[model samples]
Structures are given as structure tokens and as C-alpha cells.
Target: MVAFAVEHRPEFSALRARLDEARRRATVAQRSLIPAPTLYFGARGERAVIDPREVRPNAAGQVESLGSDHRSILLAADVSLALPVFDRAQAARARADVDALTVQENLSIEARRVRAEVGAARASVAATRSSYERWRAIGGAVEEATVLARRGYESGQVGIIDSVIILERIARGRIAQNRSRAEYWRARTALGRAVGVIQ
Candidate 1:
């Protein structure tokens, strides 16, 4: 989802516009490359154009006239197909240009956003890791203090307030541990989203 939304950012509209323009230009180029099929023949009269092979001998053994004019012979010559030529050069060029532009725009936006997200996630992980380590280190000290304070209270060497303070320290350590765990999970989730994997 992160990857998909990042790709759909509003700036992609400009890329889409550029693609459309390129397509339009390609259409014009394509039209221009369409070879006119009329280069070999010209039409003049009611007589249909005839192929040389269609000329037949008359009952009197004479070649038939194609038309009233002797100079009106339609010459058949080699005509080249144009689509393949255009596709190999001009159309292919247009396609490559559009592809490069599209990749630039899309990847630029995606990379910037994913990098920022990754940075934030990494920072969160670091902070949570530090907190977790600090809390774990203090946990043993807090428990020892709590045990000593309880013993001192029973022996009348420490007051109820002292015990309460020690218990509060232990409670605070536990709370910090829980908070750190939550933060770690949150950071992991953010990192997952940043990397485009939705676990």
C-alpha cells in the first residue's frame, strides 16, 4: 500500500501529461510515415486500370488496348511498406523517450518519500532500543532496592515511605520496559511500510 500510494502522488499527473503529449506527437509522426499508395499510378478515364498480365489476344490475334491513349500505360513498380520503417526508427524513439521520462518521474518521487520514511523508522528503532537497554539495566537495581527496602521496613530501619519509593522505582522500570517494547513494534511496523512490505 505504501508503494502504491507513493506512486499515485499528485505529481504523477505531470508525468501522465507528458506521456500523453509524447503519444500525440508519436501519432503525428506515425501519420506522416504512412506512405501514400498512389506513387506508381494515375487514373484518368472510365477504363479501369489493367495489369500487363491481363492483356489478352483478340479474336484477330491483336493485343488489346488498355485505353484510347497509348501513353496511358500504368506501370507497376516496387512499393515499400512504411510501418516497419517508422517503427524501427521514429516510433521506437518516441517509445523510449516516454519510458525514460516516466521512470524518472515515478522513481524520483518514490525514492524521496521511501528514504524519509526509512530514516524516521530507523530513528524510532534506535530510540526504542536505547530505552529498552536502559530500562533492562535498571530493572535489577530497582528490584534489589525494593527487596532491601521491604526488609528494612520489617526491621523498623526504613519507613513505609521508603518502601513506597522503592516500589515506585520498580514500577517505573516495568512501565519503561513496556513502553520500549511498544515503541519497538511501532518502529518495526513503520520500517515495514517504508520498505514496501506490508507485514
Candidate 2:
């Protein structure tokens, strides 16, 4: 059991890293849209003053030295300089789009990786299964030979040593077939898990 080492698979690790980075970028892009409050101030008019010459009316009602007709007034105003709040909704929608795309891309990559891993695992399982089947066939033939050899020895037609050798070889083939079968089943399980479609 060489630890299987599936956890350290490089392709899976790279996919996870890419997903995390996409999420982080989407988050940053979304947070950049909040508007900060701002204030705008400016002088609007000139100061007004009383005119002494306009205090007295003209004696002839037609002669006036000076008249105060156009006057200036000092005006101060404060206004909150805010971008139209409703416009922010559009930016928010864009942010949502970015986030959505990020999620979609990550899921897409994940699905692809899962499918690829499952395919590879399934291939391994198939090969191992074929080996197991081949070994099983060989084991059966060897077992039959061992049986014949044992009967021959009992009947004094063969030596005990040949019987023992045949039995050992048959056992060895059986062991090999058992090992292959075990590996095939283990690979099947791995492929199921990778595909997220356990059977």
C-alpha cells in the first residue's frame, strides 16, 4: 500500500487553486463599487452694502446723484455630491455577473477534472479486471493439473515432489489472481468517487 497518493494529484490541486483565485478576484471586483460620501461647497454671490447716496430722493424727482438698483448678496450653500444612487444598481448587477461567471467557471473546471479522473480510474480498473480474469483462467487450469498430479502420486504413477510442485504453482497463480481482483475493485471504487456517481 504505497499510500495511493491520490490526494496529492497535481491536476486536482491545480483546479482547486484556480477556483480559489477566481473567487477572490470576483470578491475584490464586487467590493470596489461602494461609493463614499462627498461634500461640495462654493460661494455663489457677492456681499450686499447700503448706499448713502440713495438714502435721499431727488429734490426734482428727476435728479438723483446715484441709485442702488443692482446689488450683490453673499450666498453660501452646501450640497452632497453623490452619484445618482440608482446608477449604482447597474454596477451592482455587473458585480453579480462577475461573481456568477466565476462560480460557473469553477464548477466547469471541477466537472472536467472529475470526468477526466474518473475516466483514468475506469481504465485502470478495466486493465486490472482483465488481468484478474486471465489469471483466474490460468488458476483453474493449474488447479486441474494439480488435481491430476495428486491422483497420479496416490496411484504410484508420479513422485510426491512433482505433486507438491504443482500444488505450489497453483497456489501462486491463485494468489496472483486474488491480488488482481482486489486491485480492480479498489480502482472501481476510486473511479466512482471521482465521478461523484457512485455505483
Candidate 3:
């Protein structure tokens, strides 16, 4: 039944999702207190280099051309990081974020309510099942008696009063059986509701 509630109920699933989202937000807020690190990577490729030539003053103050040592492609990478100095407000907000919401407690209460409902439903089912079994068995037996009583009356072997009594017993048994069957279905419906199924 616990598995049934967890597996079949969309309300419980939505609650779990909401809790997960809250935890994620709390974690994000917590991580905001520290510096954020980043990684940078890049690559460049070219068939030919147009700006390969470069001029610079040599040891004797003469301009030198560096095109002979140039490559067609260039690659670059760098890492950057930043830390917020004033995080008092964010830290306070992170601390203010609560783990337990009123709705979460209400969900717990709902679980207990479901448990009680399921228990009551199970008891009703048990009671109705026995009632159904008893009524159906008695109904079958009374129906046979009713048929025998009618045949006996027709053959002048039984009185009209006896025949009427048997017929009445059969009628009462049928009514009880019908009621028991209906109650059994009603109990099953209650159990389904407790377990979070539509039907």
C-alpha cells in the first residue's frame, strides 16, 4: 500500500518534486556565498595566416620580421574566478530558507489520514466480504428451498403457508446478497481513494 501510494498518486509525486526543487534552491543559495570558478577554452584554425609578419626592436634596436616562425593557427585559454565581498543579505536569505514548510506537514497529516482511511476501508471490505458470502450461500439454499416448496404445493404435498414462507426467505436472502455486494464495491472504492487511485 505504501508502494501503491507512492507509485500511483500524482499528488505525492508533485510534493516530492516540490521538495526537491526547494532543496535545489537552498543549495544554490548556499553555494552563492563562495567564489565561482570558471574554465575557458578555445581553438582556432586557418589554411593560411594573413597577419604572420610581426616587427619588434632587436637587441641592437633594429626591426625584425618574424613571419618565418609564425604558425597558421592560434589557440588560447584562460580561467577566471570572482567572489562577492558583501554577501550578508544572501547569506541571511539562505539561512532563512526553511526545510519544513506548513504544506509539508500537511502532507504528513494527509498520509496519516490515508492510513486511517485505508484501515477503515479494509475493515469494511472484510465485513462486507463475509456478509456477501453468508448472504449468497443462504440465498442459494433458500432459492432451492423455494423451488422445492413450489413443486410440493403444486403436487399437493405442502401447504400454501409453507410455500409462502420459503419464497419470503428466498426474497430476503436475495435482498441481503444484493446489499452485501453493493457494500463490498463501496468498500473497494474507499480503499482505492485511500490508495490514491481514481477508481
Candidate 4:
């Protein structure tokens, strides 16, 4: 029953999910401490016109000629990484760790609560069933006495008042028995709820 409750209870399942999410966050934070490299790819095309007549004279009086028109295509690839010099995700990791621990503790507390409820429900069902059985036995005995009283009254051995009294006792016994039966069913329903068998 405890296992069923833990598996089926919505609140418990939510707590478990929270714990899992916390653990996942913690793992991500821990991995963030390592610097991840980013790859970049770029391509460029250039078309330019250079006049040959545009010559220049150097300091040594030598003539320098400008190249002709040309087209160039450049493709580059590079990888960049940011060093973890200042922030290593320490604070985030710490927070995730704390959250995971808190959720774990809460899950444990919930499990204990479920077990306690199931135990109490089982005990209640047992007690109520015993009470109902006892009442049923009393009711049976009262019914037998009522039959005897009716027979005596018919034979003129028992007075009408006495027979009426016996009938009233039978009625009271039946009422008590019915009440006990209702209590037993109620306890069973409670047990079902505790075990997560009922909504």
C-alpha cells in the first residue's frame, strides 16, 4: 500500500519530479564550469578596381605601381572560448544542490506520512470489522430471543408486554448492528483512500 501510494499519489509524484528537475539543473551547473568552445564560419567576397596609373614614389625615389582590378573570395573558420575566470557557476550549482536536498527531504517526509496513514487506516478497518462482527452476533442472539418470546406469547406462557419488550430489544440490536456495518464500510473506504486505490 505504501508503494502504491508513493507511485500513484499526485503530490508525491510532483515532489519526485521536482527532485529530478533539481538534480538535472545541478548537473547543468556543474558542466557550466567548463569553458565550451564556439565554432564560427564566415565567407566574404570582394571586387575592387585599382588604377595602374595611380603610382606612388617611395622615400628612395623608386616608383610603386598599384595592382589591377581583381576579385577575391575569403572563407574563414575559427573557434572561440570564454575563459571561466570570474564566474564558474558556483552560486548556481550551490542553489541547485540545496534545492535537490530540500526536495529529497520533503519526499522522505511525504513517504513517512503515507506509511503512517496506511497503518492507521488498516488499524481502523480491523477495529471496525471486529465491532461489526460483535454487533452482528448480538443481533443474532436478540433475534433468537424474539422468536422464543413470540412462541411463548402465542402459547399464553409469555405476556403481550413481555413479547413487545423482546421485539423492541431486537429492533435496537438490529439498529446497532446496522450502525456497526456502516462504520465498517466507512473504515474500508478510508483504507482504500490511504492506499491510493480511491480518488
Candidate 5:
């Protein structure tokens, strides 16, 4: 019954969503041990015109082709990686992963327990309700029988002792009816608690 409630209950989806979020977060945390790579890229271009006497020369005694009247462009790209040198980060990540797993497992266990409780509560409610119904059905019959016994005693057809017994039976029937009603409500309260609707 609790299993059914977990699946069909309106509030269950939100609760399950929280668990899913926790699972995703734990998975991401577990992968944090591996360092990510870096990428870089850049480009530059320019069109330039220089005076006839603005040329530059190099130690080779020739114009170093410094683009005296040139269109020039430069492009560069690189990727960098950092090696895992220290064990501390790996150890911490591993510990965090273990903790996250533990949290999830504990939640699973508690959920199973709640499901079981829900099943038990449902059964209890049904049993108590059946008892209550039986008591209610017999209550009217007991009252009618008590009335007949009283009339019979007044007419000398039944003894005073029989009337007293009949009254006692009526009282017991009322008590039983009340007890069954209380039990039914108590079972419903238990069910509500198991479903987390009540504190």
C-alpha cells in the first residue's frame, strides 16, 4: 500500500524529484576528481602603408620584411592540461562520493520502511472498519431485543433478571460499537502518519 502511495500520491513526485536531484549532484561531485583542460585562441590582422623611408632592416643587412607596406595577420591557438599531482583532491572527491552514496542508500531504506508502514496501516484500517460495521449492524437489533425484553418483563412474560441481562447486553453492544469506531479512526490516523501527512 505504501508502495502504491509512493507512486500515486500527489506529494510523492516532489519528494522523488529531490532524490533525483541529489543523485545527479552526487554523480557530478564524483567526477570532480578529474581536472578539466583549458583552451585558448586568438587572431589579429592589420593593413598598413608606410612611407618610402620607413622600412626597417635586420642584422642580415636586408629588410627584415617588417611589412613596410604590408597586410599582416597573426593567429594562435593552444590547449593546456594540468596533471593531477596532489592526492588530496582525489581523496576528498572519493570521500564525498562515498558520503553521497550513503545518503542515497539511507533514503532508500527509509522509504521502504515507510512503504511497509503504509501497508500495515491500510490493513489495520480495513480490519477496524469491518469491525465497526458489524457492530453498527447489530446495534439496532440489540436495542430492539432489549425493548422486547423490558415489555416481556412488565407483562410477566419475562423475569426482571432477564431484563437486567438484556440491558447489560445492550450496554456491551454500545461499548463495542464505540471501541470499533475509535479503532477505525486510530487506524486512519496511523495511515495518515505513515503517508507523512501528519506529524
Candidate 6:
């Protein structure tokens, strides 16, 4: 039951998720200490005027170069890497580690709480069941007395006052029995809740 509560409780699930996220953050921070290479790629176009001496007159009397247009495209690629001269991620890693530890402790505390709750609920159920059974027995005895009182009164062997008193006692006994039964059911419900079986 303790294990079931820990595994199925929403609070525990949330804590577990938080712990996982904290651990992931810690790992990322630790890895960040290792520098990674960054690659860059670029392209550019450039235009340059041809020298007057290189220009020639075309057949249509227009100035044109002997080759194609004086435009050029340049492509460049480079990779940059850091040497990790300083441990810049140390503080972040430490913070993440602390957060993970805190969450782990919280989860442990919550599990302990659930265990205690389950134990208390079980005790309550046992106590209430015992009380209910005892009350039921008392109620049965009271019912028998009521029946005898009624018979005596009908046969004129018992007075009205005594018969009235027995009837009242039976009523009170039934009330007590009903109350005990309700308490027993309530305790069972609480036990179910503590075990995470009652949502």
C-alpha cells in the first residue's frame, strides 16, 4: 500500500518529474563545460571595373570586355572552437545538483508521510469495526428485551412505564449501532484514500 501510494499519488508524480528535470539540467550544465565547435558558412558577390587598357570596342561600337561580366562569387566556410579556459558552468551545475537533491529529499518525506497515514487509517478501521460489532451485539440484546417487554405488556404482566423504558433503550441502542456502523465505513474509506485506491 505504501508503494502503491507513492507510485500513484499525483504529488509524488509531480515531484518525480521535477527531480528528473533537475537532473537533466545538471547534466546539461556539466556538458556545457566542454566547449563545442561552431561551424559558419557564407557567400558573397563582388563586382570590379575592368582596366581601360583591358576594355575593347565591340563590333557594334560599344565598350565590352573580352571575357564575361566582371562579377565574382565568393564562398567561405570556417569552424571555431573554444578551449574551455574557464569553468563558467560550474555554478549552474552546482545549482542544478542542489535542486535535484532537494526534490529527492521531498519525495522521501512524502513517502514517509504516506506510510504514516496508511498506518493510522488501518488502525482506525480496526477500531471502528470492533466498535461496530460490539454495538451490533448490544443492539441485538436490546431487541430481545424489547420483544419480551412487548409480550409482557400485552399479557398485562408488565406496566406501561416499564414497557416505555425498554422501548426507549432499544431506540438508543439502535442509534448507537447505526453510528458505529457509519464510523466503520468512514474509516474504511479513509484507509482506501490513504492507500491511493480511492482517488
Q: Residue 91 of model 5: what lDDT? A: 56
* Candidate 6, residue 181: lDDT: 98
Candidate 6 lands at a TM-score of 0.65
Per-residue CA lDDT of model 5 for 1-199, tens digit only, reads 5665566554566656666766666566656755544445555556665565666787888864444465555444455555456334555556656665766676577678777889899899999999999988888898798788888988999888877988888888888889999999999999987876665
The lDDT per prediction is 0.68, 0.67, 0.71, 0.83, 0.73, 0.85
- lDDT tens digits, residue span 1-199, model 2: 1112234445445655665665665566556665655668666777546566675666676645365656666677767675555355456556656666766676576566666776788788889889988887787687788789788989998888877887788778778878998998888888766654453
Candidate 1: give the clashing pairs: none
Ranking by TM-score: 6, 4, 3, 5, 2, 1
Off by over 4 Å in 1: 1-100
Task: In model 6, state the lDDT of residue 149.
Answer: 85
Please give each candidate's TM-score.
Answer: 0.49, 0.52, 0.62, 0.64, 0.57, 0.65
Q: Which numbered prediction scores highest in TM-score against the true structure?
A: 6
Candidate 6 pairs with clashing backbones: none
lDDT of 3: 0.71
What lDDT score is found at residue 168 in candidate 4? 87
Q: How many clashing pairs does model 5 include?
A: 0
Error of 6 at 141 (Å): 4.7
- Please identify model 5 stretches exceeding 4 Å from their true place: 1-92, 154-156
Instruction: Give the count of colliding residue pairs in each prediction.
Output: 0, 0, 0, 0, 0, 0
Between candidates 3 and 4, the one scoring higher on TM-score is 4
Cα error of candidate 1 at position 102, Å: 3.5
Candidate 6 structure lDDT: 0.85
Give the Å shift of residue 28 in candidate 2.
20
